[model samples]
Target: MANASSMKIRVEELESGMITAENVIEPGTERILLLRDTILDSVMIFNLKERYNVDEVYIRKNFSAATVADEMRAEIDIHQSLSTLKEVFGSDEDKPLTEFSKEATKQISNVTNELITSLYADDNILLKMHQLQSYDDYTYKHCLRVAMMSVTIGKSLDLPRNKMRDLCEAALLHDIGKRTIDVDIIRKPGRLTDEEFEAIKKHPQNGYLLLRKNGSYSEEILNGVLMHHEKYDGTGYPLKLRGEQITYLARIITVADVYDALTSNRPYRQPWSVAEAEEFMMGGANTHFDYDIIMAFLAAFAPYPVGDRVLLSDGNKAEVISNNTNVLRPVIKILTGENADEVIDLYNDFKYLTLSIKCLDKDGSTGE
Candidate 1:
């Protein structure tokens, strides 16, 4: 039996290498399925779901703060994913989309599987997403970041396994159409001409065509790629489909696509702060994006999750204790001076309303 302190999570939440807190037994017999303190792996998790019909299991929450953060990082190899993407995108320069379809789908599918695994492997999904903010303007990196954000949002909405897998792949390939366009226009430092913007808008249709040509992707994935640019207010390009008229997965990807685009640095403009980018995302909920998906994105893209140490505006240090309703103004415990360990609810407590988080603390110095 799990102790009171052990966190009980659903089977789908299990991560590789997480130690079991208690014995998992077969339903009919007294036979123990897995012993207590068992280090979990993919096979054990699958059997727990399929063979034993286990819905939830207890895991030891004994990792250090640094180790806890590490669980969410480097799930898929960035270099490997980028290398595979470059190979596929390179085909756009030499071979036709048709020529690379099979190999591309196979490799992308493998990466998507790893992406899903990495997402589920930790409790701090937003932390993983937040770490993605510092990425470059490379097409592969942008697509990868978008896929991570979209999947994080999808997980927040409780999307099923198959749908989530489809969503990730769609987001990863949503910008695939850009590969077919001329490199100069895509990377130009100056503002785009109307003709160039129009050409950029064709990416969704182009990506849809490329994936559809493969005949391997699901309709949900294909539609997501085609309609990711569709706005909620019917103002976006291509189909201009609005509201729920857009496919569900496409709607999810739309929020993530815009968020990643805003946060990522460009040739012409600097990257927006995470808080600034999130505010923009929240502002566009009903017009530029789906309201529900935007809400999910907010919930999943916490810039300051609990357990993160931060530097305060007034030159103090604190650890985030909770990320209540307001993502920016979370409950925090001051780590400086006389008020050490005192919890302040930045969103609710009026006494600390004047205070603000400046940035994440690389080192929790007392600001002395």
Candidate 2:
């Protein structure tokens, strides 16, 4: 059944370019089959009915007037909600179990709901969200970022609606166990002792126990929270599960979680540059991460985001105006030198093979 603001129709009746209003769910589960705002074509419609056995889909009441602002609002709402949750949780250090459980469920639900609503609305929304971030609260912002990225990867893989929701919830709450750890250890400004590092590794189990004690979340969700830290190379924490032993949802969250952690600023180290983070993930492929999921993560990000000033191999400076189908290459609009104002399509031009991005143009300097 569709929500009151949306409508439902059989997959057979879906037309090309009609936007899905809600995530297409697998029957009787939280897995997401297709994401909302997915513009359906004939093949997709066929696949929905045949390949995945999706019967009907929910669609927004109107798409004619949809704008990027709607997606922006959803992003803002998530940040605001997370901020509120932080305040509520911090108000009383000795708050009851019911209080922690209640607020945790409410905030997870709120954040994931916003993620579901705005995920497929526009490809640019996540990039825009990144630009709007403030580094005040690492846990709240980091969890939300991981949730969005995990959902993006899930949608790319065509995960069922129910599984997608589960993935989102799992990723969003994966760090909830940090609440139980000593604040001094969790927020330490310096590198930790070996004992403290061991304490840090206990978060996954602590989170799993907390959620299980809450008595509301599913076993799958608990497993996801418990195992997201397990490595593909058989070297992670707690039980040290490896390869296929880890849950698939945890596998997806692992990639997103590590990527955000590497790229985000922490007290002990400066944030890795985006290029550095991407390279690090690729290098760890098949070792720290599932290879296929890493490829999907690669596809989800633009190394040089749109609007960045870049120096080209051909002695020209340009702005990344838009992306092409390739994540590494983009359509650049030249800003200086012989090709000023020229729109260069790196994926198409024959000479593009000989050229590459030299560096990002920073204030009066070029940055790698």
Candidate 3:
């Protein structure tokens, strides 16, 4: 057995390679179907239920209950941060900042600090704490996600503490200029005219000017906001800065920005699945995004988030239970087909069956 910290699950739900947390006994016969600490496989699963008539088994918990507790706390912290951001930028449309003394600005920094602290507190709790948001208040929601993602990339890069803080702050406010844009265009349900698209492109410059006028932020922060739209190949708007000319902070945020934008639901389109988004980003390497930052992002966030339902190449649908080092191939709890509720690691089972994520279930989990 894997100690007392195990969770009991049904026999049908047992995943191959999971060490038994407790002994399995046959129903009404008192016969031991399986011994403690046995590694479960498909063969054992069939024999235990069909031959020995066992209905349940136990497996070690992949994560601790404390992770759930930490997630709850993180949600509260994120809520507080969003509230502060809303107060600062919600109604400030067309009213450019002339001074930097507002309490709201300081509160935004404080909120970022708390978020950075919480993320560093536990690596496992990083993506586990993310909460899905409604389509309403899209600006605040998007900015928050970008901030967290940028911070996550910074952590993966093992950046200095001060650099991480600055990166997160810049990420959180990178889209502040969008607040001043006309809502009709921002949320247009159809393709924009050339003029409308041009208007949208002005947001980065608008955001930079607004922050620079406030006179409170460092040049790095201001540049990050200004140049985030700048692409590596010099095709980006406003500045068209290429390669090293683009600020490092801006380059990092750009990867996070494009990722959040693509994976999120907009008025014009549904959100892409996690797999699709990652594939898109990977395709953009060196052309639309910096290759190094893109690689850092891949290391930071897994391609498939836990609990996402995915259709497999073999025509089975499964819920992701745990991630392996290989992001594309995770351990899944099969939810349907002949192997209902059984778990398997796609990476390890390559010889038996070819596996690939067909598509994510749209209703069950957030693709981000």
Q: In order, what lDDT does every prediction score?
A: 0.75, 0.73, 0.73
lDDT of 2 by residue, 245-279 (tens): 99889999999999988877554455666667887
lDDT of 3 by residue, 89-140 (tens): 7653435443344575687789788778877876433442234233456778
Query: Which of 1 and 3 is ahead in TM-score?
Result: 1
Clashing pairs in 3: 15-343
User: Which sections of candidate 2 miss by over 4 Å?
Assistant: 1-72, 87-103, 267-269, 306-308, 313-326, 330-355, 363-368
Per-residue lDDT tens digits for candidate 1, residues 1-368, read: 12333567789989775756555666776555664445566877998999889887766677565664355234335546667777767743453343337878998998798789877875444433433333243677678778888888898899999999999999989988887676777767788999998888788898888889889999999999999889999998798898888999999988888887877655445666577888888888899888888878888778775676788898888888889767989999998867888999999999988899988764442121
Worst 10 residues of 1 by lDDT: 126-135
Segments of candidate 3 deviating more than 4 angstroms: 1-69, 92-101, 123-129, 182-191, 305-310, 314-326, 329-355, 360-368
TM-score, every prediction: 0.70, 0.69, 0.69
When superposed on Cα atoms, how far off is each prediction in RMSD? 13.8, 15.5, 12.6
Which candidate should be chosen as best, given TM-score against the real structure?
Answer: 1
Give the candidate order by descending TM-score.
1, 3, 2
Give the Å error, residue 108, model 1.
1.3
The alpha-carbon lDDT assigned to residue 9 of candidate 2 equals 79
